[model samples]
Target: MTTNQPGHTFQVDLRGLVDLLSHHLYSSPRVYLRELMQNAVDAITARRALDPEAPARITIRTGVGGGITVQDSGVGLTEADVHTFLATIGRSSKRTADGDLDLAEARADFIGQFGIGLLACFVVADEILVVSRSAKTPGAPAVEWRGRSDGTYAIRTLPAGTVTEPGTTVTLTPRADGSQWLEPGTVLQLARHFGSLLRYEVAVVDRHGEATRVNDTPPVWERAYRSPLARREALAAYGKATFDFTPLDTIDLDIPLVGLKGVAFVLPTPAHPTKRSGHRVHLKGMLLSDQATELLPDWAFFAACVVDTTGLRPTASREALYADETLAAVRDAIGERIRQWLTGLAASDLALLRRFLDVHHLAVKALARYDDELLALLLPWLPFETTDGTVSLDEFCRSHPVVLVTQTVEEFRQVSSIAAAAGLGVINGGYVYDRELVHRLPQVRPGTTVTDLDPETVTAHLDSVDPGTELAAAPFLARARAVADRLGADVALRSFQPVGVPAMLVDNREARHDRRRAELSAGADDLWAGILNSLSSSAPRAQLILNHLNPLIRRLAELAGTADPQLTETAVEALYGQALLLSRRPLRPSDHALLNRSFLGLLDFATQAAGAPAADNGTKDPR
Candidate 1:
């Protein structure tokens, strides 16, 4: 017997809606001021469309008990407009009487962040009083609308001459807890904070009847400078005030197509790759968000920026840009502007380029990982640690036509000095991006070859000892070889410079990794051991290279067949242990055992030689 109605009015509870806006939609209650300013801007923009000479001004007055009145000489609402846009919570510019709201049309005419116009006021106020006269319609009666936070609103046609001009006046009676937000000090601060760069004139009137103008200063990028240094100093001051740190440098940014202008501050210190703070963005001169991250490309995280745009529109919350085709292009264009600054520095200013790279090289390196053109432009300027001391990649590459690089820090340390003594050029590529960048150099510069260095490669460059010397030290070499077999290593005698190093351990990364897996497999459960053993590789065994040119090896050779044969065993353990220490690789169980046994054996030998009682070999208190 009953027919269900498919369409019905949405029952909006104003109290709950206000709370939702304060807690979720808006970042803070202070943004209520921004919402008001945006509405004023929207109205003024609409009025200017009909009448270009329309007064572009907004005035705010504070009264007793934290009440605020905001008046704007903008297109005001008629009776019907008031009912639809103000009294009816869900109604807005989009809705027409007969058809659905023209979404594009509504958005185009009122582009200044229609953040539930006039409804946001209820967040800080218990009751809102609005009196407006239509600017678009002549001989229209002024309308008065009173809306409260209890979901009640009333509308009435006021007397003909109550509002003399075509504009809107909104008065808010602050709630008990919102008094501080509406105070004179807070009003002034917030008005200037949100409206300082607004194109329209905004004024705040005090209790004593004096009005202070807010929006007196233009944005930093628009300011006139006496000279380049003067401009730099001004921008530097602005950077310090806004970001709380002195920037290393600044890049001026402009996108004339979108009527956007800003400055990017290169941070004085490194920035984390993720979790970056957002840029400050202003729409039509009002601050939309101080945290508009999507406004720039992801690579722009190293720079802090403040931009003002009239060409882009904000989303519903009015906090960030609505992502669309235009926004994507704008971000690309802004990234290009920053890119040009670096190229410009490369072309003209070497000293400045060096300074900037010292702080932001990592950011550039990250970008260069993708862009080949940027890599080519900045390759020479990049720094590298070479055997000839730290130098430019250009200098290192030019001197050593075939560049040699090490993949890890310890490997570079093992061979850097010896390679230098043997007239070999080696570059330390242990740092992040170093190896990849070195590998990529040939792609940019034609004729440069990058070689990967390992212990075996360095060993190939050392001079070989004569066979007769090896024969003379055959017995001692046998002892060394026996000790090396326990650690799955072999022994070699080579004559190289830096003879102070008695022995050196040389192993490539793959061999070291495979050795570690074998060690782990030895100690694992049966199932785990099988799984780990399956992962092992047939890599080259590690080598303990003894320096035949060193005096220590010569003395050991003299005691080849001594009566005390354990002397050779103890000496070989100590030498192998020292070589392991120099390599700086993480020690395995076998390595640890060898180090302990060698240390105790050497201590016992030294004590007996000194004719003193040998120290206890067990874990006992010496005292």
Candidate 2:
């Protein structure tokens, strides 16, 4: 009982193995077609090594009752070969009995390695039947190998004439779950999707006996690069077929050292910078993946690629390319190709460059961040919003050597109208990547300087009032200063060009923070208010600039001697509240209360001047 048998072997749980192959090893049941096609292609290659004149073709036929037959003209199997290769899992037929065949040195150019490729059929089928004849054994008996998904198989020698040719035919009877794939249209579509670029001829024979070839024989990418005209036509067709959009431009790529060749399509519309670049990768003319994103650089989202490479290896599922040294080199080469296209466009075609920038400016901006060549050429063509209108950086720099830029859309909106009225050009750098590019302008162009147009800068641009006018408005200015202090802002009288605007509230970053904190803590207890005040010690002060050129301010200055001092103070508070509202600043409760009281006081003053009895609480008095 304790003695061990020498020939004992571990049994494979076929059900578990099938489940792993179907769900884990392969990405989808659809890949079963690809694996079957790959095995057929390798078998054809083996037959070519034995007989150079043999036809290498794979023909697929779909039956009415959920059955599929794939027949290939290749080196098939004898009775013993069927038991050794077809029966045994993970046993490759490419090797000889003596030793493992040097696959690299073999003339068959085998595309299959793991014996699991044949087993892939079981993922969609309940049973698989194989009828094959050996090319080496002429006039010998053919063999049939029947394998079931339930871990059982049968091998038997067929009649001498059962298979009249040296080839193999694999038939699959689909399970209930996979019956949808038995349709001729579905089979044909999957064939085209997986084997459209395969070297050998592949045809799908439908239930009506009509045979349609699915593969492109030599593949379009291989032939298109032979001529310039062909390349353009092929890329246009490929783009429309693959992505449903015609490409704006096509870039042909070739890197012989790493065995990479492809075409990159420049998308017509703006692509989000975060989206993954879709690249269709093929290995030895067989489709690998339609969404091979790792083949391109991250910033290359504006382009889609269809590439073929013999050097790169696919993963176990054969669904995607492995990221190896070869792939990294190819990625860099493809990036360089895109870079050359942009630089060439900039050098040769201004009209086209402008057109490209109109749609794909964000992509260009991303590239410019790291690429100096693109930055140098693209900077002049890039457009930015200005006081006049949209203008190119080149035009802006020429007209206004010292560029005035606002960092935010809110800030730009507040100042743009005034800047336009003053005949000053202010660049809106609020958009994505605009501020960073503008800030970097000085590094490239030594004389160009970008100044942030904050509230302080706007005040600096305002004209100072003459000394005589300042003296005449001193009494009104003092009253306004008192009102501004109560509102936590400084008061100034500046002569701005907009005579219609009586007042303007200007604030820098720190000043805005201080004002916000003051408003927020106005309702807090004394301890919290004290803490906030201490924290805001370093914060800047906000300024309320009264327009001396406006008639309202001139009248207020004239009333300095005649108007009651309290009336002057009330008028100053109302003007400051109006300034806050005009600047889009959130008014505090106290400011609202002040404005309400000022309205009532002005109403009472008007009633007194008209010599009419003031209605108490809006009730009309009967006299």
Candidate 3:
């Protein structure tokens, strides 16, 4: 095992590697400017370490025929440094002790990093030329490195005055298709887009010989304003400019441990609860990403944010954050900041908080479902649809001893008007997050009684008709029961308030499930029919409650006893059909056809009666 033979290094395909970087490693070729800026900023940081008063400046100029020259006043490289860093891939001297690049990367200082950054220029350029004069060795000769995309490089010591300053100038000769990205307008935009927040004097010089400075001031969130109103207006304006919509409010985000600072602008309009929130994020004052979605909690989709952090880690492409414990901690910390914003609203800004709830109550309800503190603070102000009318939960709870809730809007609508007359408190829990939030009502209020509504329970509270009246109506009741049987329902006589309503559809959850199963079984194949049939229940389906107090029903009953049977049958069927339609439930296909047939039959009967002469006995059917 002690052979003294020469070792051979693996040769790399530079073209293939560049293709990989362009297609997979980086999001787009636009990141070439970011890589160059990162190198320049790190070099300046190194120079600052050597001399505290060193100038930290970076300048970019677009040369003739679509070439880009980036010059930085930083600590340049020696000949050996050029050979080691520029000539090798995935190799750098800026690593930490023990050479481990873990989640805690060593990028806080001006030390150089992974050699892949310079190679990213190959994504756009065919060749890269670098001229540098070392700051470490003031008397040493400057070095020039010319690297091409064909896996070849040349480094040499340049004579005096070739590079007069102790810094580096990198020039890129773009490929045929990269000329657009190398133009003066594009170069200036890319420079400002990626380095507008860098902690240095950065500027872009165009072909017109004019220089426009970038990163000239701090971020808007970090600046001081004259008054609170002015600060609010400025933040709103910034949000509108950045996100294209003015924010309803702004929440300051700070995590000292990670050196993360941000402003989360609460979106003004309703935001989808499931859609991800993409927040703008900057790493070490450099624009890292505009759509970093992992920095906030899922429930915080109601915000669009701009953040800058010095401690978070970026991926190799410098496009997104590295998912690690630090990122998790940062996400949790941001969630805590948002929670504080909501709690602050509850304590001091009641009107504004109510407005927020009106627009984003679904988001709050999602948060409240698991957060005990938030549940207590927001439960009183959250609105719900109840028999008493749409009002806050606190208002509904104070008036009703027992709270009745329906799992579907149809179920609530079927009995809402009637329930109100019966002194029942029924709330619609059909909306997203509403049922879960209501089920947790007891956690917020100790004595709150919450139960799912059963239509049968509502039916039981209805007043019972006297035995004499029931007996007198026996003929009509018998006919009505037979008619209801064909429709898969049971008929009953009840007396309720506001007798204008002729009949009500009271459908229980179990009956609804059974009806759905029955409908499926009718269309299913033999095997599926058997399976569905077994799952169905023997419980009765939707009930048809005929209001005995309604004048129309009373007249119909009288006709049922004395008039022709055909007339009574048509009246009973029409009453049940009207009730079913009012429930707002989807009608079965067979039911729809039956309704159509009945209307046609009625039209035929009316036409015959209209054309025929007046009855000799001066009497007509009450249909």
Candidate 4:
């Protein structure tokens, strides 16, 4: 058993352990430099704690031989301290005496930890040498520890010229493959990415003696909210910085849900990050999440807020988050905050809110259908039909003669068109218009159907139709019917006499009969489906309800019984198809062709009657 040689000492190389930590634990090799620098910074922080007036800066130096030095005037370590801190891996001050730290349940504080940071050095170095003296024991001899990961380490008293100051100076000799770490650009990039937010200033020194600080630690998001600027200013700023900010979506909550604080920023449309949506969530002045879309429902994705909550479960990597009681409370709080803020925006900034809806109206309308609780807050920003252009739902209800809210966007369009045609200005209730909601709201005027009409077409129709006391009915009905036939559907003639046009399309489904049928089969009812199927089976027909008393209808009926009945029919058909086309209905090609042919023949007949002699071949008018 006497295998040991006399006067011999065993020495171990520590590179293997360092390699495991530096290469295995961290994502990359460059992180080793960051970790060492971070440790130097921490040392200085400790020194400052002991001596508050200590200089708050970290210095770096590099040598062409691939030797890197990190120095700090912070807390240093004695021989015993170094042995404990470096010798025992995975040990940090963040842990309790029992070595139990509830990282998941802890409040959000980014200490930049995980004990393996020191081992990161092996990523670029074959050997590490440190010289340090604890600020608490400035007179104590500084310590030196040297080793590779092979087996054991060598702890010895500092050599004569090893250290002259009370701080840390860690020198790393680069491995052949790791020489690239000494490059100035590589070093600067690492500082910017990981240590940008360090409280103390950090500077990188290059081989040529040049130095650079790559970070501006305090970004604007760290600032508190200021008084909101004018709409134009806010809008312009929002457009310029939308990429760096969260989207501002509004919500209405009856009460606060969690302890979250934030400033509202109305962001620009088409933000860079789709999830740049929602509030920029934070904790302890540090960003927790950018979108925070998960905390709120999909409808709330439009808000750009800075939601700062103290409660969160931030993982060690600082890249992911998890929900706990604290996070839940925060989520609920944010929801309520958004709701309240939206309500305020409606009251104080109604016009701006309306402008937002003009583009995001679809999202709002969808919410209106599903989120009645928020309807009160959203209604003000909704768009309604107006003579000047579309107005806000609030403005529409206030200025227009009639205000109506529907369950779906399509339904709202239909009702508004009817009202507009009757010269009874109308507004869209909110964002949504559900066909099923016809029962909840008052029926649009009897005999006046709210037919679907695109805004552009509506404008054109109003421009072309002469404004009169009563509309002409018979000829208009015949024309409307012909178009409806081409579209493979029937257009019901409105009994109401609107001043703007000779004929107005009516929403048959909005009538009492339609409502009754809808109610009878509320659960997965096939009645409407059946109606569509039936309509599809037959040749398109339009219900030509005769406004017998209207001047236009009377004239057309009188003309029907005369020798020129064919010409009268042709005229009615042309007008009807034109109206249907404006309503966005599809016309059957054959029916359209028939109407076209009839109109051409009538044109020829009219030519003969106008004293423009007929063809000499004696081809009678095709009619």
The most accurate candidate by TM-score is 3
- Number of colliding residue pairs in each model: 0, 0, 0, 37
TM-score on alpha carbons, each prediction: 0.86, 0.82, 0.91, 0.58
Instruction: Estimate the TM-score for candidate 4.
Output: 0.58
Q: Against the correct fold, how does model 2 do in TM-score?
A: 0.82
**TM-score quality measure for candidate 3:** 0.91
Which rank order by lDDT, best down to worst?
3, 1, 2, 4
lDDT of 1 at 60: 91
Q: 316 in model 2: Cα distance from truth in Å?
A: 1.4
Clashes of 1: 0
lDDT of each: 0.82, 0.81, 0.84, 0.53
Flag regions of model 2 displaced more than 4 Å: 1-8, 94-102, 106-110, 136-140, 224-234, 406-411, 420-425, 430-432, 442-446, 451-453, 467-491, 497-505, 512-537, 542-623
Error of 4 at 172 (Å): 7.0
Q: Cα-based RMSD of the predictions, in order?
A: 4.1, 5.5, 4.2, 10.3
Candidate 4 structure lDDT: 0.53
Please name the candidate that would achieve the greatest lDDT relative to the true structure.
3
Across residues 263-304, which tens digit of lDDT does each residue of candidate 4 receive?
455554633323536445544334444545566545555555
